[model samples]
Target: EAGVVQSPRYKIIEKKQPVAFWCNPISGHNTLYWYRQNLGQGPELLIRYENEEAVDDSQLPKDRFSAERLKGVDSTLKIQPAELGDSAVYLCASSKRTGGQEKLFFGSGTQLSVL
Candidate 1:
């Protein structure tokens, strides 16, 4: 089975600029998740997708950040007019996901730096 895949590996952008990241999760995975990792803090749940439905996304900031899972296989996350504090690792992860458990595997992530 393939692991999660994320693009660009790194990104550098100016404050107030828009940026996006992509992800392709493992084959046959039933659940997918997006997490935001700041410099020294734990990864926070940005979104969780079960098939085509966004099962959990309460923590995602609506004004500037948005995400979608179009086919239930791949997803994208976007931040518009990003802030300096938005510079962080956007990690994509996946799991088989059963019985309310999501033992996940993560990708290398897109490391965005806002300047």
Candidate 2:
């Protein structure tokens, strides 16, 4: 019944610091996604999870970024040694269906500022 939930709506940190974001997808949802949106740009998928398995994560920067969806429910995204370029809105979304035609419900997003 609830929509996607994300914590720490905003975060500010210096470059090289580590940051983490949390997400709780809607109940019964089978698909979850993490996306990054730079200013004036559309959200770009960072990772996508079908239940507990990460089905797509090629866009995620592995060196300093990591994510996990445990128990096919909640998920977390972390960025270590973050750079200024990492400043952006991190969005979490979920869908009940795996088909491409299904609509995704998005959370408010975490706004990160790396100085």
Candidate 3:
């Protein structure tokens, strides 16, 4: 399946500039994440941190995008020298195991428009 479709909401910014998106996950959750949704595609994991340690960040563009989770509660995703193709929605999610299953909670997302 293609997953849920996304809308075109965005935060406009010029090219070759720096922009940052912040997220605060639900309380008591141990996993925090940063994802990027490009147009109609599903959200792609940019970075996943398990209690302040980056466990998965291979999909992230280290040359341009950087992320950090402070105390494993709040997270910031920054992109320097934003490109036009960077226009998309940035999603933040948190997950925790409950009843032998992973429960994920997502944020509304910050959509970016690189001009």
Candidate 4:
């Protein structure tokens, strides 16, 4: 089976510019997650979705970052007027509850550089 596929593995933009990342998760996965990883820190959850509903997004920057899961399959994350601090790796993951446990699959991630 194929794993998640992410587009434009890397991106470079000037400060105050806009950027977007896309992810297509594994088939049949019911839960999706978006995370951000800085240079020296572990990935932090930006958002989580169950189907088309956003179940958790407290960590997402509502002022500039927005995300959506379409039909519970494809997802996109966008940042407008991105700042230099926004440079990092954006990760997309998916999981399904099985036998009382959730197993997650992750994509390679999109690396962003805000100049």
Best by lDDT: 2
Each candidate: what lDDT?
A: 0.91, 0.96, 0.81, 0.91
Best by TM-score: 2
Identify the superior model by TM-score, candidate 2 or candidate 4: 2
Can you write out model 2's per-residue Cα lDDT over 58-83, one digit (the tens) per residue? 99999999999989999999999999
List TM-scores for all candidates, in order. 0.94, 0.97, 0.86, 0.94
RMSD to truth, every model: 1.1, 0.7, 5.5, 1.8
Tens digit per residue, CA lDDT, model 1, 1-115: 6689999799999999999999999998879899999988889989899987898989999999999988989999999989999989999998887456558999999999999
lDDT score of residue 55 within candidate 4 = 88
* Model 4 alpha-carbon drift over 4 Å, by segment: 98-101
- Name model 1 segments beyond 4 Å from true: none
Off by over 4 Å in 3: 1-10, 97-101
- Model 2 scores worst on lDDT over the 10 consecutive residues at 95-104
Q: For residues 1-115, write the lDDT of model 4, one tens digit per residue.
A: 9998898899999999999999998998888889999998999999988888898899999999999887878999999989999999999999873333687789999999999
Clashing residue pairs in candidate 4 are none
